[model samples]
Target: MADHRAQDKLAFLLSLVPYLVDHDRVSVAEVAAHFGVPQSQIRDAVRLIGVSGIPGETAQYQHGDLFDINWDDFELNDQIVLTNRVAIDDSPRFSAREAAALIAGLQYLSALPEHADRAAVASLMAKLSRGASAVPSSLTVEATATDGTLALIRESVSTGVQIEFCYRSAQGEAQSRRVDPLRIESFDADWYLRGWDHLRQGVRTFRLDRISEPVITTEPITFRAQDVTLPETLFEGSPEDLLVTIDVVPSAAPLLADYIPAGAVTTEIGGLFRTTIRVSHYHGLKRLLASMSGMATVVEPAEARTAVAEWAAAGAARYR
Candidate 1:
């Protein structure tokens, strides 16, 4: 509570400094009434302002009656008038970390639907992206969820009601599951609903994209007072990390690096660019390779090589 009060006081003080800088002079009694603080507190705030000056403006501005502060200048009507103050346009300058966070947030926003906020997001991204020290990376991806689905999920989870949704697995297989939603959270730049699979009797994370149709069940599921934790290990559907070696064109390695996991990365050994990855499904990778216009090859991960072989054979047979 004490911390909260101090934070509130700091925030109020910070807000006042900007107004003072904008207007040059402010009445003490009016300032107090405006902020709903006591007259004594306002006096203390005025005294505190003497110690706070814009950086590099100390030689010109000094503490004096020219601090020119007067408590009785107003009509005692609690209206503070600022006059003869210097304007310091010291808005926050983003550091590299702050800039990266902003870019990531914008990318996350881009993945969502185009709302009124989307225009603001686009404008902000354009402004930041053109900054002198801006990074050469994109954080623009967006996705949309079912209307009112979020509220329904929250209510169902809190009340321990069963939720049935038509979920499309990563393999593009669609099925329905009656789940007791434990928690819904964002991860890896996407939203996930983690819950107990009453049918499977285990925890599962449902990707927002994969959930095509949601149907809430009337049956009340037994709620565990304790929170159900999401699975620590994911992408285990793949049978272990199969060491896949793919030879990619020197120019394409960088582009391919974006699609594969950081750990399973493209490496340059000697003159050749190679990608070593473990994949559960080969279809997506195959399609990506086809789109690359024969710039990439699957050297290892015998499973991927076999799939590619079959794909090639089918193409050859079609031509014949």
Candidate 2:
């Protein structure tokens, strides 16, 4: 929390100018309460703001450029009075990436008919684009959840109901499971349903796209305090997970950075980049290696190399 003080102070300063201008005069305690910070912090922020100003004619902080605060009213009494300050009437502008993020989120929200105000979303996106420094022409975000899936998940969340769905695991196995839906979240370009999995007897996060035959059950959700406190990191590597190394071509090497764990060493040997990646499961690794075509090859761990070879051979046989 202490590390975020600089950010908090900047935000306070931006908001303080407008707030002080609107109220004309306000107590230090009132400002602290409104901002949800301690009075001392607010006083410190005010003191900092008083010294902050635009450069004067002489290129120094002169009296005309400095923020004027009524020292008598603030120091003697616990009140604040701003005599003069630069006008901060305009709202803070969003950067290009920030604008893009909001626009993308609005696009996702606009996909759901139940929660969408289509016109408002369109208007806001237009405003964001106009305000952005430079909007990217090629940036795009695909909708992660289908209308039916989103509707059912949202209904279950709102009514505290249990939901049943046929989930296709990463290993390509399908199984029926009932879950008390807690929340729907989007992470890493995918929508996930965080719920209490009845079959596993634990909180699990299921990718929405992998869910099939979803049914909003009549049964009410069974309250579990632990479900609400489930960790955001749903996937964890186990001891059984494979530590497989792959040699990727120079052009494909950079792409592996997104998939490989941080601090994983990569070295270029004979123009091919080699890096080790921990595979949570063989099926997932096989699928990833298959998608890379012949650009990537398993270099070590004879088991993984053999598995990928067999997987590739099978795929080749299908085309032949």
Candidate 3:
């Protein structure tokens, strides 16, 4: 979902660059009103044009000032004229490995239970990988059932059957609990069982991966039609609650943008773009942070500072 939204925003922004270059000194208010975006957002979009360029700026397209945008008199004089003819064209580039990975990832996302619309997913995946002609010949993902735990959980939730299971917490601590199954969910590449715990007397999310023993229940449970607990609060203590910010390149922004809330991301006056995201856990954040190595930079939560330092130290040690 995040990936889809980010790509949409990138397409929107990239689409605007051509328009801006074509009609220089465009009316800020007019552009915003036309696009249904805030005036500030349009200004940011103009700033983005200043830094983005096709390659070496030559006679065809000037390097830096290809789109000579002047927002100084932007408010009163809402007209922006293109001093240089900036040729904005989409040159799609992808490595064989990257192309293959994208195909594999799309397949995994499409195969999830929540994303049962395989046809729609396939269409979208094809659209995303249009530039990459090389298609993966065969892709298959597998998940071994935990002694009918998943089947039992689904039936138990529908049938209002109480269940007991031994599970491991995120911290790898062992726990045994009885819960009245409510709803099952898949998030961030894992399935979760959201239910009302008998002992804790509160809502809990049990990770399907951490279920050590088989789920079994002798007693019948009553499933309430009304929600007993807030869905937002259920993930409060999880890593998804951790807020993170990073400055990313435009190319990478399409991947990270949707993870952040709309209107939360903004470009600096100088044209550097940044995104803020609320991650669910430390491990997930670590993985995400590691993947975007050079393009991503951590910007908030001083606590993450320690983790960054530790990671850097580890890398340094490896090199040494």
Candidate 4:
């Protein structure tokens, strides 16, 4: 628990500085809401940062050695306005082992939903590789459950039988599915089962983590690997998919990588980036927007914004 707490604090500090650098002048409440932390914690962090810095050649604190902040604005208006920064460009370069460990953990996070806190994990993985002092070692997610999931998928694929399971989609909907297991594929640390779905009467992909109570049916497979041609790409937008245009703040732009397809372009206007992403429904779009903190806005499809507004209002009403 202590280790986790320390890691969380480190992550928060790393993200907070970049966000502050981007905005320059932002309220404490806004920063707290953006990072989903308490105002007190943010205040404590700012205070700690004000006093912490590297020592000069004198082996003691010097004028330019420490960070400085607008103390009056912070105390009087509860605003974060950094006045001076020290060692801002000098990040601690990670060792080969350190880089490998962080890359492995980030690969694990890639399997989970991209939320406000973890949105930058995928992007940070690449930065680590480039910024590391030495070559990073081999890395992989050490998930024990993956072993059992792979075993069941392999059994169904080898026997050419149908696999039945409860699948939980990204939008939080759970449904039963019977699929003729065709192939087991992987992207990063995430494992996906692509097969012929009897329920939908089409080919579907299932994330192994979202699958539960999986059982192999005696029924022979209707679509074997040889019978079906799998797409070169993992995800193909369907007719049911809704294209949503959203405006994301510059600092939070990396969070949209998972949503933007290959060769897709983003439009920048007034310092905010506009991008389109495909979602199954308005509810899914709302969920995605909620995960982005306050960094994203629905720029098109009035209904999508309405859905998100209603969701937010309902959530706020609960507090009252």
lDDT of 1 by residue, 208-320 (tens): 66776677788897644266544554433434433567888797776654345556655676667876755556775566567776777888768888988898788889987
Candidates sorted by lDDT, descending order?
4, 2, 3, 1
Q: Which candidate leads the pack in lDDT?
A: 4
- Per-residue lDDT of candidate 4, residues 240-276 (tens digit): 7888888999898886676676666798998999888
Q: Candidate 3 versus the native: TM-score?
A: 0.43
Across 1-320, the per-residue lDDT of candidate 3 in tens digits comes to 99998897788777786666444246878788878889888877667666655545353444553555554565457665544333443355565567667777877665443344567777665544533434444555565664257666655655566878897866577888888776666665567777788878878778787886656587787544265744653354444377777777777776664367646846752455776876765556776777777877777777775777687779879987
On residues 32-136, what C-alpha lDDT tens digit does candidate 2 reach at each position?
A: 999888999889888988888787679877787888899999999978887766434235768888888888887777654234347777877876765555663
Error of 3 at 203 (Å): 3.8
Clashes per candidate (backbone, < 3 Å): 15, 0, 14, 0
lDDT of each: 0.62, 0.76, 0.65, 0.79
Q: After superposition, how far is residue 249 of candidate 3 from its true place, in Å?
A: 4.2
- Ten residues in a row with the worst lDDT in model 4? 110-119
Model 2 misplaced regions, further than 4 Å: 1-105, 110-145, 182-191, 219-234, 249-273, 314-320
- Model 4 residue runs over 4 Å out of place are 1-150, 168-176, 182-191, 199-201, 222-228, 250-266, 313-320
- TM-scores of the candidates are 0.43, 0.49, 0.43, 0.45
* Clashing residue pairs found in predicted model 4: none
What stretches of model 3 exceed 4 Å from their correct place? 1-141, 145-147, 199-202, 224-243, 249-272, 279-281, 291-295, 312-320
Model 1 residue 75 distance off true place after TM-score fit, in angstroms? 10
Candidate 3 vs. truth: CA RMSD?
21.6
